[model samples]
Target: MSLAELLALVNDLSQSDKLSLFKLLAAQIPDAELQVIFSASEYPVWSPYDATEAANILMQMIEDDKEASTRA
Candidate 1:
């Protein structure tokens, strides 16, 4: 059957059946192909911990703004 027809049939499947279909399809794929499809990479994440410099800069900006407002 065409992919569109197969997808339509798959759409009608229950959640458990869909999960089974996913496992079956994944089993057919080679390890290398799966690795390529799901590449591992590190991503930088921002944390508030050890952010004293940023906090100081923000406080300075606030102070500058307050000083400017008082002068106005």
Candidate 2:
């Protein structure tokens, strides 16, 4: 059967059966593959909180543009 047909059948399974099937499939994956799929790495996330320097620079640029437009 095609993957779509298999997925459709799997969709009909109960929650417990789905979990069992997932465990069975996950067990067949190699250790390296599993590690890559579930990586243990910290990723940096950017936040605008306490970004005063960047906000000041952006405000200066806007002011400069306004001044230049008035001069033109």
* Leading candidate by TM-score: 1
> Which ranges of candidate 1 are over 4 A from the true structure?
37-41
> Tens digit of lDDT per residue, candidate 2, span 4-52?
9999999999999999999999899999998897887889999999999
- Steric overlap count per candidate: 0, 0
Error of 1 at 20 (Å): 1.2
Error of 1 at 45 (Å): 3.4
CA lDDT scores, all candidates in order: 0.96, 0.97
Model 2 residue 49 lDDT?
98
Least accurate 10 contiguous residues by lDDT in model 1: 34-43
Candidate 1, 1-72: lDDT as tens digits: 899999999999999999999999989999999898789786899999999999999999999999999999
Instruction: Name model 2 segments beyond 4 Å from true.
Output: 40-42, 47-72
